[model samples]
Target: MPAVCAVLAGAAACSGVPAGFERPEQPVPTPEGYVDASDPQPISEIAWRYGPAPWRTDAMGDPRIEAEMAGIPYAIEFYGCDQGQGCTDLRFVTRADLRDSDDPDKPASRQARVWQANRWNLERRFGKVSAGEEPGELILEMNATLAGGVTRQNLDAWFDWWRVALTEFQDFTAR
Candidate 1:
C-alpha cells in the first residue's frame, strides 16, 4: 500500500512539469452573446448591424453579403468555413474602380493606382489596400477571425473599427 501511494504521488508531481517544461495554459474561448456565431444565423444579424445588406453569392458560390460602408459598396465574405463546423473568419472587401477621364478613351494608370494603394497601406493599420487584378481597380480589405467566437460588444466594436477605417479611406481617396 505504501509503495502504491508513493508511485501515485510521484506520477502526480511529474505530470505538473514534463521534460523540464511547465504545462502551457490553454486558451479560454471568448464568450458568445445573443447569437451562436457557429451557426449561420448570426451572419444575418451581422449584416443587420451595419444597415440593410443583401445576401449574394461569390464567384465560388459561397455566401457573400453586400453592404455599404462609409457610403461605399463592399462585400462581406466568409472564409475557413466547414459545412459541419461553420466559418472561422470573415472579411470585408471593396473595389474602387477608377477612370482617369470621363471619356472611356483613357483609363487610370496602374502606377498611380499602385502608388495610392501603397500609400494607404503605409498610412493605415486597420485595413489593407492593394491593387486589384484589373487595371484601375483598388481593393480595400478588413478581416476578422472568429476561431473561438466573440462577444456581441467586441463584435460591435469590430464593426465600428471597420466603419471608421472605411470613412478614413474614403477621405484619403477624396484627397
Candidate 2:
C-alpha cells in the first residue's frame, strides 16, 4: 500500500508537532523503531531505515503481521497491521552480519532495509521509532492469517512486493 500521512486522528488536537508528545525524557514506544548505531542495534532496524517493509500489506492480529518479498539478491519486507492496528516491535539490523550466500539480498533482508529506512524517516519528524532483533535469518515459521485480519493461520507474504526491488538489486550486482 502507498504510504499515508503520519498524522493520526483523535490522537490529539494540537497542530505543528503536537505539543512535543511528552518530553523526550520519556522513553518511546518499543516498535517506534529508534536506536543508536553506536549502541548495538536490533534486527528490526530494517523497518526503521526502510519504513514499513512489505509489498502486500494487510491488517490482522493483536500486533498485526508483516510480510517480506525478495528476488534472490534483492529483498523487501511488507509491514502489516495487527488486529486493525499497526504492528509493534519494528526491529531490524542496519549493519547485519549476513552470510556470503549466493543471494545476500533475501526477502527478509530487503524488507529489513526498507523497514529500517521507513522507521528512521518517520521517526525523524513524527517521533522515536521502535525496533529490535539482531540481523539474522528468521525461520520461515508462520501461519497464514485468514480474512478480517486474523493471524490464526499466519502466512509469509514478505516476498510478494519485493520482486521489483530484488530484480533491481540483482541487475545492479550482476554488472
The number of the candidate with the highest lDDT is 1
Cα RMSD of predicted structure 2: 17.1
Q: lDDT per prediction?
A: 0.71, 0.31
TM-score of each: 0.70, 0.21
Question: In candidate 1, which residue ranges exceed 4 Å CA deviation?
Answer: 1-37, 56-61, 83-85, 101-105
Which pairs clash inside model 1? none
Candidate No. with top TM-score:
1
Report the C-alpha displacement of residue 15, candidate 2, in angstroms.
15
lDDT (C-alpha) at residue 152 in model 1: 69
Worst 10 residues of 1 by lDDT: 27-36
Error of 2 at 48 (Å): 24
